[model samples]
Target: MNDGTQVHLRLVRPDDKKLLEQGLARMSPESRYFRFFSAKDRLTHAELAYLTELDGENHLAIGAARYLEDGTELGLGIARFIRLRERPEVAEAAITVIDEAQGLGLGKLLLTMLVLAARERGITRFQCDFLARNKGMHTLIERIADDVRYGHESGVMQAEFALEGPEGLYRALAGVARKEGHVRPGSGLPKLETTNDS
Candidate 1:
């Protein structure tokens, strides 16, 4: 992190329902709106289950956390991709960083991890929809992707980009993952692999 705090990243599990709920509650209204596209005070049971109980192949999620002095972990953010059955090579992706964790480069780290995981699962393209006012997300996608196509619907902007692109795309994402002083050795961002279990 920019402030020297270490963040740990891992595959999200079914047991993370409470963590996700608490994280959502802690987010600012604007953050929540940008993420969920609405003002939400809390997540319902079904939503929690759907978010946490991932199918691994079709739906995958990675979470970031900060460890406290007492060994408790604070949920910082999550990035996930859900494969489209009709278009298995492409997936709908989303990332959410809590208000306090925003602008710390956590979003980039999470997105890089998400892209790696999605590629491992045979996802070649990523599509995302965000509010037109969310310039941060737009900039992040443009910075890391190449040959991006965008469309506008109502107040939302839909972006689609290839995960496997020219050499510059690989370099851009690698540069983000290897950002100086942001990611350190033994920071707990693990290598992703294929799995049948959610």
Candidate 2:
């Protein structure tokens, strides 16, 4: 692919179920472990189905793609959001990218898109929790803000990224990631783009 093949972001569709499954299957063992916090790689089909019940107005999905001129999906990055019932001004975040597509800043790009969507939905803040062993997830979440909280007993790290108005979460994330040891996505990979397996 040439540099002109841009990565675009949009909402996920019902048709994306297969692509979502493929994205899960393509994950490296370590990536899967970090994503699901498993000792091994095994996601039940039911869980995958339960994961993609995307409803844009209530629950939101942000998708990343490199499309052909005809609009075929070449690669994908996805993030899910859950709007809080009691607190409509906040949303929870979960994100993923296919292994081969890593280091293109897809994670950063998807996250920034989600942040914007959250703001548009009247969300004033964003929150996410991930396993400590999921260093990439930790690093990516930490990218959004320096105010991160760790729960050692549960191995979960929580982050708060303010999403009020036009405050750019991506800009804040890029800034913090640079100063606070947030390795650029490429730094985690080998010479090839493959994810480092456990």
Candidate maximizing TM-score = 1
Lowest summed lDDT over 10 consecutive residues: which window, candidate 1? Answer: 189-198
Tens-place lDDT per residue, model 2, 95-169, is 878777776666866676577666656777777877766677777766755555555546677776676433554
TM-score (C-alpha, index-matched) for candidate 2: 0.71
Give the range of the ten consecutive residues with the poorest summed lDDT in model 2.
188-197
Q: After superposition, how far is residue 157 of candidate 1 from its true place, in Å?
A: 0.6
How much is the lDDT of residue 63 in candidate 1? 84
Which residue runs of candidate 1 sit more than 4 Å off their true CA positions?
Answer: 165-198
Model 1 scores a TM of: 0.86
What would you estimate as the lDDT of candidate 2?
Answer: 0.63
Best by lDDT: 1
**What's the TM-score of every candidate structure?**
0.86, 0.71
The deviation in Å at residue 160 for candidate 1 is 0.3
